[model samples]
Target chain A: MIKRASAFLLLAAIAIAAMPSAALAAEDGELDAIHHSANAYYLDFTPIGKLQLPRIFVVQHEDGSYGLELFRSTAAAILEGGWVAEIDHDGEEHAEGEEGHAEDGAQEAHAGEGEAQETGKYAGITLAQLEGHLVPPGGGHVVLDMSISKHLVFAWLGMIVVAFIMVRMAGKYKRGVGRDTAPKGLFQNLFETLILFIRDDVARPNLGAKTEKYLPYLLTVFFFILTCNLLGLVPFGATATSNLMVTTVLASFTFLLTQFGGTKDYWMHILWPPGIPAFVKPILMPVELLGIFTKPIALAIRLFANLTAGHLIILSLIGLIFSFANMFGPTVGYAVAPVSIAFALFIYCLELLVSFIQAYVFTMLSALFIGMAVVEHHHDHDEAHGEHHAEPTASVA
Target chain B: MTLFAASLLAPDLGLIVWIGLTFLILLVLLRKFAWGPITSALSEREDKIRESMEQAEKALAEAKQLQADNDKARREAEAQAQSILREAREEAERMRGEEVNKTRDQIQHLQEAAQTEIEREKQSALDSLRQEVADLAVSAAEKILRENLDADRQKKIVKDFLSDLPKN
Candidate 1:
């Protein structure tokens, strides 16, 4: 077991070490670890190069009319199309026309002389500058940049993979593999275990009799988050769950379900809590109200931060080797390689564990929140009486 | 750096719209295809298991009841058989005693009859002997009378002697 584990970690370390070189190449030889985790317009398949996704923009022309614009890629927009980079004037107004860069004032002045001859707006700026900051020609701004991004593609992949696996499993059940008889084989058994875990351990315990109603959503979110989380750990793959927008949307679904499915008892507990002292109700009311929104917000932030933090740490640990190499010589870099790889390996394993944990936690918490909302509170009176009964028992014991 | 940080924390509209749209579709699709069958299948399996268990228990109880009924009948039959045997044995003993008493009575009655018959026969024989002796005495007396006395006087003497011997 130990041998296999180390070998797996070694393979993972090699994969991780091989990764940053591609990301580094894209960043112009700078080890900006943040760049790897950040959202981008292209999928970075390092060693092979980057694939630019299509860019779609809702644009407003100088005539104050709205129009939709489509480009095959950032390169396409700059070269064939009429869009140019919206470079914020950094005093580098001139450098070179051929290089398409305006450097410092001295170079900008040199390029400005050349700019006088050229009339096109795309004359001075390079493709790198024009990549993310594209603007419509003739003094118009982009209204909405509805471009497909790298993370979005991976998120779709996660969704598709989950849908395929689940549909196949469901097909087996529809044919009476598990419905009439015992579930058979590894595929059915393995997925059944996860599905059962989400249902029995996660949903049923909290949602109670309403488990059936909420179980589908719980199962979907759990697998979705897990797949997205694991996708990030693979080479050249982005973590969609690490994105705030995705987490927010997920948490919002829970929030909506909680609010809509809430019983009168749930609202009553929040609005006018039973059995509280009359004076304390005023202070507690706001807190209870705030709790409704806070729960989902916390849900969003927790999953997002957990996923993002793990990626950040791994990136940073890998970034250490480069930092050491720059500070010392190549010899020191080589010396620090094993240490950084080992730490990265540890974090990677933790991340694999965290992927499952975060998925479970998110689903469990969602079920709990929804359960709180929908569950009938017959225990309110019992709870008061029980506390009274509990005190005397404590004294007797 | 600040722009980079802003972009990092920024919620992109396009991504949010995309995620919302895709996730909703995912939920709908999965709810229909995946979770629907799986959960129902599970519940169906549970129900089947529970039903078969109940049936097995019912069969077991029935078998136990049948066994008890069989045992009771066997015991009742044995008791009846025991009484029948005892009654047959007692009747046979009573019939044998009656037969023995009847046979003894018949033997006693035959013996008494035989004795009576023997007494009657002996008396007859005695009478016959007396007659013969009387005749012999009479013949002797007649011969003596023929030689010594007259016939009328001899006959009268014999008659008177016969009468006086009986009286004596």
Candidate 2:
């Protein structure tokens, strides 16, 4: 599985690198191809910056019929030249005005300075190139103007729809034993197995008889994390869990549960533990309190780091092919493309597995922590049984 | 970099809204549809197992009862066999006693008969002897009278003989 993931990651990297940069231009309308010479195609990367990025031209124009080249330079540059032409056209008027008065000449100099200041205000501001070259034979200009960010919006919508579908399928399984009899579907089997695992392995063992009361929270955490993790694997989807804010909020909830559910015994031990040396209590209390805060912090970082690392690795592998393509030519780029694409595909599949594992680990750990807080120590019972009860030590406050 | 920071810092209001709504709906659905039935089913299964165990215990008790009855029957049959044997022995003893008594009576009767016959024979013998002796004496006296004397003596002797015979 690991090898396959690596192979898929490599292949995906290569495929991403080999994709035509011009395709990106199709999304952004404010870019135009100004000139092409020999081996290099000079195209505006963004009209905001006249900085050129390398690209390939699929079609050419003749007689400047498309007229897209008109917006190539900034409006400021054109206006600067227009001022020179205006000065030449007004040469006769300027000589006539100079003969009228020396005071008038001083006023004209002030007016010219004011005009220069106005020109500077509008300097470097360019009109956006929102048009494209036309195709041959009874042609018209192609205008590329659409919201590029809409892709991310659609991706989020897709995630929600998929989540709904999964929830519905899980509901079907929950509805009847007949549906549960066949554990063939992915979501159904996953949900059923997770429910049983949490009930028997984590919740029952830790929470014991009262585990049923807390099963809903445990199940919710597991499915919620799983959904977010899986969503991150889809192409162009934002990783909500990869964001620190999301994980932190989740960890905070766990912290709240742990604190709220804590038994009197749990708090007592944290505050004034039995059988501890008199001098040590003061020092131990602070350390115990610090430990309490770190629990949620650790939960937050563990989830955030794991998810972010996976995404970074995928992104870096794809980036490697781009760097390689730039260093060499398309030939080496093409040759290595397959290897990187295969690796990316492999990584995507691995992410799917990681998604479930991370979710399970998070839920299990949360249950464990909550269990610790609420668990009855039974020190009194032990003492009554005529056995030597160990002194209860201070834990997280 | 600024755009990235802005995007990150921006509150995910959409997510919070969606998640809160989704969680509420899920909680309601789960409470309504899943929890009650699943728990009850598990409890029911446990009850069934316990019931079957109790049933098996009852069956075992009944089996033990039948075994005790069979033992009792065997004991009763043994006692009846002994009683029959005892009755047969008593009957044989009584028959033997009757047979002995009858044989003793028959022996006694035979002995008495033998003794009576012996006595009768003895008496008859004595009577016959007396008769024989009297006849012999008469023969001798007649011979002597003939020799002693003739007519006169014979008359006197006849008168005396008649008187002696009347007296005898």
Provide TM-scores for the models. Answer: 0.77, 0.50
- Model 1 per-residue lDDT tens digits across residues A1-397: 9998998878687557645643354332124455567788878665555577888988888999999989887667877777786654432222122223323323434443343224323354342443447877889888888888878889899999999999999999999999898999988999899998998899987889999899999999999999999888888888999988899999999999999999998787788777767798789899989989998999999999999888878877877776677568768878987898778778888998999999999998999889878977566542573463344225312
lDDT of 2 at A263: 92
DockQ comparisons of all candidates to the true complex: 0.26, 0.03
DockQ for candidate 2, C-alpha atoms: 0.03
- lDDT values, one for every candidate: 0.78, 0.53
- Candidate 1 local distance difference test against the native: 0.78
lDDT at A328, model 2: 80
How do the residues A1-397 of candidate 2 rate in per-residue lDDT, one tens digit apiece?
Answer: 9998998777565435322232132221111111110011112222122231111112223444432222222232234322111122133234324434334444544453343333333433221111111122323322321111221232244345545654565456456542424445666566556667877887886677658767767766676677777656653344556655566767777788889999997687678655667798788888877867788888877887777666656654554454455458657766775776667656756776788888887887787778767777676632442232221112222
Please give, for residues B37-70, the per-residue lDDT of candidate 2 as tens digits. 4444444545666787899899899889989999
Candidate 2 chain B lowest-lDDT run of ten: B1-10
